[model samples]
Target: MDRISQLPDELLLRILSLLPTSKDVVDTMVLSKRWKFLWMFVPRLLYDDSHQDIDYGRFSRFVDRSLILYKAPALETLHFKLGKICGAGDLHVWIRAADKFSVRELIIEIDSSSRASPAILPRSLYTESSMLVTLKLNNAILLDVSSSVSFPSLKTLRLVSVTYPGNEFVNSLLSNCHALQDLVVDQCPDDNVTILTVKVASLKSLALHTSDDRVEDFAHGFMIDAPNLECFHLRDGTGGFCVIENDMPNIVDAYIDVSYALPRTILSCITSVQHLDLCLLTTEVFFLLQLRVVVLTIAYENISVSVRLLILQDAYPVSSIFPCLVRLKICTCETEWLNLLMRVLKDSHKLQALELGRHHNRGGNVYWSEPSSVPECVSGNLETLEWLDYEGREEEKQVASYFLRFGSCLKKVTIKPESTSYDRDKLVMIKELSFLPRSSPACQISFD
Candidate 1:
């Protein structure tokens, strides 16, 4: 063991890197005298406040001592999460020491309650433009970074609850990080915010989660110039968020959640996307379009009969919106409205899978009413049918009976009940249908 510990410093450093944090590596000092010094050579430094009752005074001294003891320039990563006990000055000192060692990745997280004003990063650390490849800052502030503060080697940046000077601050950050491929910003403060723009060419993935108040002003009207972007996610925004006009012929996946009033013209900008998830209020004006694979969720509260009629009038006809859709999922609180909606899908010959579920109400009681039978046109093209929240009631039996009669092509039918009390009549009805063979085109049913 002693001989093993005496191996070259590089080999010992690689062994210490396997430990998650510096303290964990330090604990190995009890193994032998040689192991005490082995951890000092590890290239990665991790400080997690939750793991220890850190004394700021002692911690400051320990960090300074550690830096002096391990004089070699070897650190590659410095990850620190400051809890309520640490102050900004303590963090500043450690960051400066890590910069001297040429750390490549810097991850700093401040306590959620720590509202200290943003500190200006040290001149050498921010402006040196060394091997720093990734930077992540959470619940902190970034102040006074000039438009020329470029990080040519940085590839990924994530900011959460961070306050910047203005939109130009964000624009300048993106411009400097030319090699950035992934950018994520969530819950960033917009008090002094003026403008936000994205003009990165190499960016491939972007996620924006903004405050409800700033959703329209900050997120709605923006342009993205990344042609190679493949994955894009926008959340909690209103006023029909639209993509900045770009020719991303290679774009394949996207998720957009915005207000009900967004115009259909926003979707026209994305013609090549293959996977899409959206939640919207039904509109009266139907702009004819087709999707190969789509998961659409519609939500409303206290819908009235008149509103329902309006939805039937202007909502994009199911046939035209998903003409080539192979899978369909419908989630709603109004099960009574399913009969009318299924009638529109009956003509969609390409639909192979169908899922229907009722939304679970949190605080209020869930009232289950008898659902009417499926229309004759509801089942021929579907091979699979899943009914969620089934309550094994006589009304549920009537709904199942309609599927048995019309869903001749169904290979499997699953009924997921919220409870285990199976209605004897429903079980008998299902058993009778399950005995029928596919050649005879009888529905095979299962209950869970």
Candidate 2:
């Protein structure tokens, strides 16, 4: 370690930069006099005080001291993971120092579960941090944000569960970030933002989530105009209006998990996406017209039997929809599984792969009764069958046996039981599946 001190300042700072946390870098100063100020020039600083044993005053002092003496030419990354005990003044000073050092990336997370209020940010953060390229703030309060707030160099901004004084904050702050390409905003249940306006033209990726826990059912929503966006994920449980001002021509992938949040509006904007993962609470959505590979999340326990039938009819248009369908995945809550399975299998003429995921303690038990006629896909086209968390129930066994008895083209059947299943139970299931009649001579069974 003594010989390491002989290294030049640049070489020493570079070596210190490899440390995971700022504390590790600071601890190196005790090695020798040559190492005393080396950590101050390290490009990266990660300070986290989640450990319960940490003294608040001591933690603040260490962070303040580190920033005050930080002589890095340009801070590449500065992460502060302090809790509610940290005041705005302390954070303001640290952020100003980061600005002074020309930080490229800044991340600050204050615990939201703490008894104290959210950390209110200082005005300097929005106005002075012109050099910051990436900024992420969680559980912080954004107040007095200027309409002229400029983050010209900033490319990514994530405000998760953060509070904004008004709905205007989104449009006002994002308008100035000319270089921003990635944006994420996960609103808290009580965030005062009523109508978030995301009108950035340069944005390439956006993930926006709004909660529905608020008691009032106001006309809340979003106004989007990002035409160049390539990736989008929207989970709006608030059942609000979402207006897309322009078409997203460059969209490649999207995941939509919404509830009564106007499925038509959601579909119109994501017309050009190459891939989509959709989740809606009701059966009003019917965009799976051209689905080749479909993943259905089934939780139809609470829904009335008539509504469930309507969901199958409207959501998955069987006659023409499954003609071209090949692969299907159903992550279900064990709610009337046989009805949904038989409906799809009956029409999916070219279906080849089937994957069933059974989530425990959800919905209701599925009682399987043999179908009158074997589907064409099951007897001829089906090649692979996968069951995740297979409980080896009698109903499950009957369904498994039915597939084995009829699937002439079955290549492999894989079964993964729940973690709590005993080794003896697994062996029993394997033996039972092995003894079952197989229509295909080369069919293989696996349980592991």
Candidate 3:
């Protein structure tokens, strides 16, 4: 017999609770008679049916038996994923059973191959369960709650593909969750929620992602007023106007990813952020649209209205606007990114590190534009420069040469050439770049 089997039942049950799934915990029952009923007392239960080999009939039978036979006084966590086979009514019964046991953390993932209808969440979830500290629902429906919603101890809430009656229900649900700290809403596809206002005073971290496939004609957006928020992430799918009423003076970091144009209001909200990341679709890369001041025209019959726009139309004088910015990273393959780089270097006087690369997307070429004057950072605070998937094009070489020549306080410049380039070509580019005059005698140029 193994020494582990000799441990007390309490210790054995604690050991089993750390496993990834309750199914794994049950499998240990066959180890010995002492282990047979130990899993029944485990505080955490997790069921996942995403695997292709999962036997639906057997899994259902197992869940039904587990809930009935479970003897734990209180469940620390209860998680289950009901795929296409399980009905919403059955899931409601499961939630009620878990509620009887006083579960503290509950995660239900409803993934149905059928898009015809989404599973409806039980009403008891909002009105009766006060012990819940964490709640996550995916691909589920939340019916309108006319009663006062309650979850006194709840701190984290994540809803993905969850449909509610309308935006008011969502607002009411969040407003009542007084102790919430982390909230995530991802890709909810109901037309009833055209405009959403999230006003959580206690929220500290928030993430919101919308679908990129939204129709252009739809009126959809969000308004936020979280005063004490520290971190925020927004992955916008299209052009939607987002308004932030309260200034987030306590914000430390922010990540913004958009498929199309970002609203003007967003940039102003993150002025105090020390770290910032901007990700966008290749078609929406700023400099590609910056090559010329293009006049976008709309015509009806013989009449045309011409609208002149800048690359950063609503956001100009980037440095003065972001006075607190310290570190900046740009992930783009657009050749015109250098133009934006110059503007940032001129404005962000406190910037310490700069990173440039193709982020999550393939690389192409870097376009070179003559800078009218040397950027402030090139002569002062800039320390490190790193570039990934560098193609060593002529424009890239010129830009590298300019930075190497003018960066008086620069310490390191690291470049990684794209895999398509020949080893000999990389060496030639390295030697040529290495010979350029460096303003900072200690500045080192390394190539990969």
Candidate 4:
């Protein structure tokens, strides 16, 4: 009568392991007598309280029952996503249970807003968990760890919005993890860390985000010495990692978002990056030598990082050759974007697609003027242009007219006007754009 349920327990447990949550696997007991206790034998368990109408009392009881009665000798994964109602005492017991099970992967996410301060994790999590492979703690607290601790199997560790005791605690914790490969530290305000130091030798990926809003907040410096890093993401509001030392010849991709200017040492680190996403540039850090897919920024003196899928975010484009670029997306809301667009278009000979982002009300100081000559990409390689939330102002019409008239190889024009624009005005704008003479007779205009 039940063909699927009649399969062997091992095969059923394998399917149960692939489930989204352990709750669903536990609920499968209603299927038949064969699955009545199958959940207890499964080596993986995940519990999240975000589901509908599940309060903390019910969530805590279910977790306690599940962990206490678990028959699995060696758990590979034990995850918990709790809300603010969960007390820190329960977490201590759960972390101890994970240690006893020798879990390989442990992820704990607590709603940090529940308490005045983040709950400090049990020290055994740092010292005793030799079987852990991946550990992620969100909205947690880390006390000062001595040099005696070690995580021999830890490879990926993420501490998001986590409060740290001090800089020494960070260095001590990282140094103990000899096998760490991926590390992320997104600090919270009032976090005691002033100087974040990362000196992992086996690390391949590192992402650091620190914010300092006031003058008193001290997230001032960074000392990184990872020679084998392949990718890193750094977002520092107060220029914390500007003067970082050493080079990463193994770096293949890098994402940097900083406010203050950085020195030459920062550029030397990511010279071999094949993909880069850089925002808010204040210094002339010269583009990467092996850049491939890039996120551009504002006010660059010279453009050098040539990559596919280029994004320009509210900045003037400097005159620079982009030989490797194929697609350009500009999201500057200002109406005075013709110069910015043309400058980039002139140099990107291989460019094919262009997307103009939503126009904003606050216009820039610069006025629109026709380019002296049509750009090479416009007449040769350009294929498609999309204007989102097209306002169809006088300057906007000039941009549309210039591109339609000169783009010889253009294939399509997609215009999505703002919903607030008057129907009559939209019709007139569409008519004007449709009537504009195009160098490519096969080009099609799409209006939405």
* Comparing 1 and 4 on TM-score, the stronger one: 4
On residues 1-448, what C-alpha lDDT tens digit does candidate 2 reach at each position? 8687788887887887788789999999888888888788888899988666788899899988888788767899899887647777887888888788899999988876653777888888987798999999988888765446889899999998888777666678888789999999988877787778898999999999875455433255677889999999887755544567788878877776554324455555665655445444322222331121122213324223432232223433334334444776554453555665677678668878887774334433567889899999999899999987888888888989999899999999999887789999988888888899999988898877
Residues 1-448 of candidate 3 have per-residue lDDT tens digits of 5898888877877889889887898898898888888888998899877566787778877888888999988999999876655665667777887778889899998775644566788787886578889999988888876687778989999988888888788888889889999999886556367667789999999898886555542135677889888888887754443567788887878887654343345666667777777654443443333332232212212111212232335433333466777788776654456655676678777787888876556554566767788877667888888887787778888888888888888899999888888999989888888898888999998887
lDDT of 4 by residue, 363-441 (tens): 3332568878888889998899888777788877888888899989899999988788999989998998999999899
Worst 10 residues of 3 by lDDT: 297-306
> Among these predicted structures, which one has the highest TM-score?
3
> What does the lDDT read for residue 413 in candidate 2?
94
Top-down lDDT ranking = 2, 3, 4, 1
TM-score of 2: 0.73
What TM-score, to 2 decimals, does candidate 3 have? 0.83
In angstroms, the error of model 2 at 97 is 1.5
User: Once all C-alphas are superposed, what RMSD does model 3 give against the true structure?
Assistant: 5.3
**Estimated TM-score per prediction?**
0.66, 0.73, 0.83, 0.70
Residue-wise C-alpha lDDT for candidate 1, range 1-448, written one tens digit per residue: 7787779878887888888877787778788877867777788877766434666567667666766676556577888776545655666677777667877788887666543444334434466545678888877666665436787888888887777767777777787788999888775545354334678899988876666556343123344677788777766443322335466655556555444233233344444554444433332212211110011112323222332232223222233333444555544343233442354355345667776664333111223443365433354467787877665555555555656566667778887765544577557655654554443155566776
Rank candidates by TM-score, best first: 3, 2, 4, 1
Q: Of models 3 and 4, which has the larger TM-score?
A: 3
Error of 4 at 284 (Å): 16
- Score residue 47 of candidate 2 by CA lDDT: 93
